[model samples]
Target: MHAAGLGKQSLLIPKQPLLLLHGLFGFRELGPFVYFHGITEPLKSLGAKVVATRVHPTDSIANRAAQLQTQLSQVLKQYNTDKVHVIAHSMGGLDARYLINKLDWERNIMSLTTLATPHRGSYIADWSVLNIKQKLKIESLFKVLDIPLLAIDQLTPQYINECFNPEITDVPDVQYKSYGAWKQFESKFSYLYYFGQLLAEREGRNDGLVSMDSARWGQSFNEIPNCDHINIINWSESKFDIMPTYQKILSDLYHLEQQRELKWSIR
Candidate 1:
């Protein structure tokens, strides 16, 4: 699990620092728990300056975006850099998009790489909200608990398709890439396995929650096989090891940085 014996060659010194943004119900560090478990230290060892940001676990994307913008500004200042390459997972991708597009941070972000994010939206969110509305009617209770159902609403197909799609546009200067994970089990024992089957039945291929089609966005896209939503982010409970995938992504970003530098030199 350590990067020292990973056998991967250290990468060239990066031009821009890397910032990791976690997904729904994510935290930077809680005791020994890390949202992006086994990610930051390995990347740092490879000569990439990396930082994982913490945001509201259950707030609306706009609210989280604002918080990320503030945190990113502080990070930029701390590193004495003008821009950063972002690796965002799940809902964090939406927050990053909102920050770049709506918060005027396009120029401050070099590239964005999203992992298993519901770019088009998720049916599960729709189902959850609908079920809650009909059965629990816990809107008031959720508000009192500071649980933002608005965040869940934003992840629904209607919001992403009808509202969010129109409001957000890709910035020309920033490079964008997306990766999706597909759950590959048919076991009823695993809740995520069953959920993946349900989504696959209706949506073709899915990573338990987000469908491959829904997770696809950005200029380039990739599908990672044999992993669920949480697994794609290298969680401890993952069925498969995802450390190599992280290394590959970081390598791609290094290439992107090289390309950008080459273009700048030509100009």
Candidate 2:
């Protein structure tokens, strides 16, 4: 349930490619910085074909999902592989879900594992959509700034509950699992503390950006302790290391893939 019982070790070499999807305003890489820091090298070392995808940094869920689909399609064609294992974080998880369920990618994506994804929705986003007039005014502000704002509006509780979730259902036999990030609010220097405080009153526990309740979407729901939303991606000033957690996820994904394949083997 926590970021224990996990360590760096030789991992199962995946036959199917692994696709890494980033959250809101995420980039595959910027100079030396990467979205999933300390992730790609290890996966490549494990002989896993990894594709860290990039989509529009700030965009609507539909637009983001379309970009994801295009990238994945290109990757699949390039690698000559039909199956892929998707690991998504934050809003990227929503994008993955949309591609898999709404965009007819279920047959290609064998499994989806999300971390700190606001699958149900987030209170912080709801805070923005206080009322119709206010929300519209905010939208107008974004337009004046020449910034697209659908992604923010879509992250609210109302959108996911009444609109997105109702329309998107997990395809049968497509494995879905999710994990949450957990951290104690101790640093006023970090904004996550404030967000966590607000989420605590409404959603129990959170990883600053998304509540544990909101992070849960699929089957397995676990919390990576001592991790905030940013630290889960290994961008932390604290001592909490994220590589072990990622290792655990990759190992579990391999085993799950094997099991699924065995279950459906042409016996």
Candidate 3:
């Protein structure tokens, strides 16, 4: 029922592999999803083809989802297949959720693996706004959108209302899993870096963008430590091993492979 040999590899290059997406204000090239060269290559090593989706990272999650849907439609047509799994980061997960829950695409996807996605919004995004230093930075995109800084106090109920939670979105039929990373901010100049690092240090958890409670929106969660939102890609120039996280991610996908077959048969 899983399109025959969903996980098994053969001559045709297997399924459409994984679709990776970037978060808000994040382009295809700058984030860990893209900057880290080995990110997808390692997944490819698992007999899967990887596709990085490009969308206007600054756009609202709704708009981004619409654009990604268009992109995904083309990709599916190109591969001549209807099912593809997703690995999204930060706000990218929000867009992915919209694709499955809002666009009537529940049946088209096999699994969703979110890394540092703010399922409940970010507390740091709120804390940063109060600081005068944060007001004039490129990372202030969210603050700019809210304007007057204090308008929506980081992950406010209103903010969540606007981003998601309209009409009680149902959890889709496919497998879902998440990972989170966190770190502490020691200084202003190092705000992004340190916060990202804290998100990474998760004594028990991260990719540093979203907290454990915020990231795990699926049936199960794959916990990792010492990696921030972008660190998930790679440590830029640092020689840290990101394979462990990828391994956990692959494990989740493997489970989804089985789950998809079961669900397909049920249908």
The C-alpha RMSD in Å for every predicted model, in order, reads 1.9, 3.3, 6.7
The 0-to-1 C-alpha lDDT of every candidate, in the order given, reads 0.84, 0.83, 0.64
Error of 1 at 145 (Å): 2.7
- Ordered by TM-score, highest first, the candidates read 1, 2, 3
Candidate 1, residues 109-199, lDDT tens digits: the string is: 9999999888988988877787875478877787787777677888888899899879988899998899998877667777687667767
lDDT of 3 by residue, 1-267 (tens): 012222334222334567888776666676434543566665565576778888774556667788888878877887888888888877788788888887888888878888877777665555544453356663466456753333223233347656465742656576777777654444456426655554445322333446777776777776555455666665433354666666556665666577667877999
Clashing pairs in 2: none
* TM-score of structure candidate 1: 0.93
The C-alpha TM-scores of every prediction are 0.93, 0.90, 0.73
* Candidate 2 per-residue C-alpha lDDT over 112-180 given as tens digits, one digit per residue, 9 for 90 to 100: 999899988998887756654274686677688897767877998889999999998888868899999
Worst 10 residues of 1 by lDDT: 2-11
Report the lDDT of model 3 for residue 262. Answer: 85
Q: Which residue ranges in model 2 land beyond 4 Å of their true spot?
A: 1-9, 129-141, 144-146
**Better candidate number, 1 or 3, judged by lDDT:** 1
Task: Please report, as a residue range, the 10-residue window in candidate 3 with the lowest summed lDDT.
Answer: 1-10
